[model samples]
Target: MFAARFHPPMASAPPLCRRGVPSDRPAAKDPDAPNPL
Candidate 1:
């Protein structure tokens, strides 16, 4: 669960942050929803 909590920000922090400017909250939220391995 830590990975789920941390990985997305670690992986998508830049893109997420970039999109966050335009309110792309879902983009970040989407990753957390997936149990991608």
Candidate 2:
């Protein structure tokens, strides 16, 4: 319940990172590290 605000920022962060400008946004590293394929 208290995490409501975090949820939106979490979703928005990834898309913004993909825009290329935020290439250094640590969040992007998490997804790529697990999918070595």
lDDT of each: 0.73, 0.75
TM-score, structure 2 vs. true: 0.47
Estimated TM-score for each candidate:
0.29, 0.47
- Give lDDT for model 2: 0.75
lDDT of 1: 0.73
Output the lDDT of residue 17, model 1.
76
Q: Count the backbone clashes (under 3 Å) in each candidate.
A: 0, 0
- Give the top-scoring candidate (TM-score): 2
User: How far is 21's C-alpha from truth in model 2 (Å)?
Assistant: 5.1
Clashing pairs for predicted structure model 2, backbone only? none
